[model samples]
Target chain A: MPNTDSILRFEKVTVAFGGDPAIEDVSFEIRAGESRVILGAAGSGKTVILKTSVGLLRPDSGRVFLFGQDITEMKEQDQFDLRARVGMLFQESALFDSLNIEENVAYPLLNQKAVNCPEDQVHARVEEALTFVELGHTLEKFPSELSGGMRRRVGIARANVTEPAMVIYDSPTAGLDPITANNIMALIVKERDVRHATTVMVTQRFQDGAIMARYKYDRATETLVAATPGDASIAGLKFLVMKQGRLVFEGTLAEMEQSKDPYISKFVLRN
Target chain B: MLDFLKSPVLAVQEFVFLTARTIRNLPVRPHYWRDILMQMDIIGVGSLPIVLLVGFFSGIVMALQMSRALQTYGAVSQTGPIVAITLVREMGPVLTSVVAAGRNAAGIASELGSMKVTEQIDAMRALGTDPIQKLVKPRLIATCVMLPCLTAIADFVGLLGGYFIGISLLNLTSAEYWTGAYRALEYDDVAQGLLKPFIYAIVISMVGCFYGLNTRGGTQGVGLATTQAVVSSIVWIFALNAIITKIFVSF
Candidate 1:
């Protein structure tokens, strides 16, 4: 299932700002039900990958294929039709501070014509997503009222409210404490397991301990090995390292650890 | 100068395409009705007091000044036709547009521009939603529709203002003034005035929404967008008003 037909396919995708390439000739593929994390520095075009795939920014060159469809040439309405298949969370929560939590979750649902959903059902889903993120009781609260960690949770809730097949997260753990970041990482893992969603994650965290700690292995009943400790244990989690918008490495977590890739080594060993 | 002319033409074409895209997108975007209603509230209902106040005073002042000036030549009765003609043809339409450009244009541009700064527009696009259709069309539709209603309101209020001054100050009998006003007003004059604002409506709403959709650079960008929306709209309104007035008056 991981490699049959890529859920998302990028072939020679390139993005530039002001005629200078931020990333160039980047290509990668993620299949259905697989979770991938892109590791890179600040200007490394990690978010650009998700932004281009979702049509927030168009690529200067190359193709973006989702579910085997070329999304680059699709009309906005078609893109919108495709939107239900993909959800993205900005590095910041990106909640409408003007709207409170419930309305923020309901924002996307309100944009359709036949939101003939019962208020109770919609309300219930709002609460459910909020509860999933542990922000259930703050439905009327504004984004301004939420803490940084809480806002990230709310952002995750809103992105998942549509039950999208794929969720793109930009630095979900960037500004939080170690404990809070772990909670968000745990939620990211939980969401994939529960929804069986394909996720693309961008993070700078790459320590072996942190990498192993981030996931709980469902390796045929061997969830974790007491002999080894790490910050990531994401089951079936695929990792990609990008440099200046180009693909630097692609492999499993263990493979990344073993490869003598200097960029990966430099990123992984950083304090 | 060459660069300036080139950009304006390119900008106009860009606006035209975006406008079409926005209109074409109306059926897909949700919250359109809400944005439309909010625009109506801002453009039509919110501006009522000022419009009424201006219309009334302008009407009264027109009657007074016209009557006095005409009376010096023993043609005071001509005030009726003169005030009626000016109100129906120019003041009612142009003033209404100017007011709209100041108020609703600023509001639409800033609302959109802030959304841009915050990535709410990006969020919409990511959701496969068209920003113009989701954000621009409703406001544009609301503007064109609301302007006529506002103009009509201005007409009624200005006439009443004329009535107040004419009867109380000029000592013109109510019957004589009303009869003369009705006699002087023509179908084409009123029709032409109502029609002129539609273009201004386009200028106001479209320009405002355009600035918003293209907003970047955070808070300063939004503020600049708001200012640009109002300034561009007012300029366009006056320019179009001049062209329309020439066509109407010649008729």
Candidate 2:
């Protein structure tokens, strides 16, 4: 179904690397204040689609529109301005090794000129962001000193430091133990609830995708609380399942669980 | 075989584009002054010991070798002039740049290459920071500013080393050595010494950044980039040396 109210849209986008296709004719649209979880097996080009949405990778054919503007051919300076509204969490957590966590979180605030405020304000914002991730005590620690889970949290903090309208998470929990993966997902849900920010998350783990679909952060108790069964808020979240660089299934997690397609059912069983 | 022929042309194209892009970013807003200072400390201050040691030894060796040859012609007093002119015009800048190419170029390549592999560079872009301006421009400025300073240090220490060698090893009088050395050095020779390394500095830094930013494969790719950065930088250093020397001499 075509989404005319898309805050992010990809129309017939095809991306290739060195003559081999990574994502082919992929089309998807994400509305503002909505959360999307893209699930696929390894080598399924989920990350490629996420990158294209953020303008890190340009589509070989067709157009990518961010906030109704075609970024495929946007001027670089304009692109930078456009990118300021979007935040991306890389699969590897991509924190600058040279910078400690405080500097890393403060990077976006410092660079985006419109946010030029006093140094103390920047520091307070950085501290607030780190606190949001529950890693506030690790502010002075470099990325090398953090565990994989801690690094991912710092990546989350840095990504949302500017309170961007759209956030892209590319396999945020790919290589971690299940417990750590759940912890990261909870933080992601917490941020989504608190900021009401639009999110596009790519993950290979079906359980993790389901967890995001089924959870909410309750600010009253300050905890990631599971949504009541059959809740309407859960309906705002969507899922896209990819196989061989094409979207095979797109719907709610309930639809995914009841999907009659053999491939989708197999993923349901395995995950 | 097909790839072999196309590779160098493609590499040159990449280098040219990177050079132009980095220069274009230099005058733009959002200058990374702190990064530039950090690079200066790394490239200039860090490479000092090696540059000084090489410069001093090259001068002493040249004086010792040239003195014997001069004695054969009954022109032993000319040792200081020959050593000074060679060190000032040829040996000092070239040797220091070669040392820098080996140490600093490889360091820059590996550092940037690792950042590329780890996706920190891409993260920079996603965060609205231009990697060329934030990463490459500061490095280019630092290297271009620092290499000449290192060369000047090398040249001065080299002359002092020659003085010591002339007076102590060759048994030449201090007056004869100092007089000949000062007389042989022309303004053009000093200008050539400083000018050549400035050009070489651009070449080395750009080549390093090009290969570094273009790195792929992973850790293995970073290693390959490091080797390529040093080898290519050294090659360009020699090539530019000959070309710049020709241009200066012709003028």
Candidate 3:
């Protein structure tokens, strides 16, 4: 039985590359308009979970439901149609090097048959998406021409261009200076709050998750502001801690702070 | 023993599946005509000078060698027919394909290998573009269409090289060489020449793509894949040539 309100549900899903399972019996659900930050050390299966959620990697066992449909065994062609409703920014940004910024960002609009954005509007929409990331002038630039932060921003813009129902970010701010990382996080927050799209972010940095939980993007001031108590967005922000290939913790930031497990505390206590 | 054999067996299985899927996508929509044409320029047009150079040299060498053997029999004037028949039947297709395997297979492997390591392939999939349709099919189609064309050019250039040797070195008249060369090529030789390159095109492009999309590790893995693509494509080209030639001879 699938829950209609849940946008992504992983039910005891296990994925293995060769011998050992990369993600074992991982189960979690993200409802509409909610935000989840998955935190883990290197090789803790964070990216694997993100890939599995979107049907990029099929599970070895159990089931996965996206938009309340069992997608565990969905054919790849069918998955493409279903994936049109979801946007994902892969680790390293993954912008096609051969395509310039405009073509890269316009890829989803043109390629995704399900998105089916009209031809006449694609350039305008690409410009608007680039503008949203404050990269309006970089349409002709290649990915190599941009700095790391700029490339990541382009990735964010591309992900949000289709205005998908949910967007997944894999280590959106993994290897950046603090300022750039924060700037990237602010964009993610803006995307989440403005679109009210379901957001799932995987990060190695605990600060990334903390920012996601505590801050709300304020359109009026064009900055991230502290969320007031009882803020609905704050309530929907949850932290998921993964150890090895298993989900060790799932709760609010406060619950994570009160956790006594050394592995869990390692994330909250460290930078 | 089982563990040692596992990866090789799995690799073969994956290759088979990949080949089948690439063939399946030939008629599918979202053809990416732009990509196919671009690959044509890269694989076909890009390989032209090298194919020509190789063809010319191979022709010159064959003429030089065959003339010596013919001179011993007082038949040095027959250099044109020998070179032409050899070039059309076997040398043109195999040598041109071998050159393409070295050039384009390595190119495709490194390009796609970089993309794989960088997660561009996964991103393509997530963006609702089937990588097989977008990446593999275009290369396959372009190679299939262009390799045979390149082979034709190589065969002609090779015949011209044989002509240069026949007139300048052998002291044979233009009519003597051209007549012998033109008359020596049968329908079977032409068919065999074209068919060999067509089959090699499928092998080179698919093997390059297979090694590329399956690349692992980092930069080191990309280098390994590029080398593997060239070696495997060349080996497969030779093996397939022998098989096809044997069948043609039997017929």
Local distance difference test values of all predictions, in order: 0.79, 0.89, 0.94
Give the range of the ten consecutive residues with the poorest summed lDDT in model 2 chain A: A228-237
What stretches of model 1 exceed 4 Å from their correct place? A1-4, A109-120, A175-179, A205-213, A217-235, A254-264, B1-6, B25-31
Please give the range of 10 consecutive residues that has the lowest summed lDDT in model 2 chain B. Answer: B1-10
Poorest 10 consecutive residues of model 1 chain B by lDDT? B23-32
Residue B6, candidate 2: C-alpha displacement in angstroms? 2.3
TM-score list, all predictions:
0.89, 0.97, 0.99
Clashing pairs in 2: none
Query: On residues A32-129, what C-alpha lDDT tens digit does candidate 3 reach at each position?
Result: 98889999999999999999998989999989999998999999889888899999998899999999999999999999999989999999999999
For model 3, the superposed segments whose C-alpha errors exceed 4 Å read none
lDDT of 1 by residue, A1-271 (tens): 2244678888898889979887799888887776787888888888888788877778889888887788877766667666777778888877876789999887666553223345667888888888987889999999989898998998899888878888989888887898888778777766765677888888888742244335553546633333233323355467889887788998876787787878888777673
- Candidate 1 structure, TM-score to reference: 0.89
* Model 3 CAPRI rating: high
lDDT of 2 by residue, B1-251 (tens): 58887978988988999999888888998889999999999999999999999999999889889887888999888988998899989999999999999988999999999999999999998888888999999999999999999999998899889989887877788889889889999999999989988988998888888889989989999999999999999999998888888898799
Off by over 4 Å in 2: A1-5, A229-232, B1-3
Top candidate (DockQ): 3
B92-151, model 1: which lDDT tens digit per residue? 888888888898889888988888887777877775566666678788888889998898
Per-model root-mean-square deviation over C-alphas: 3.7, 1.7, 0.9
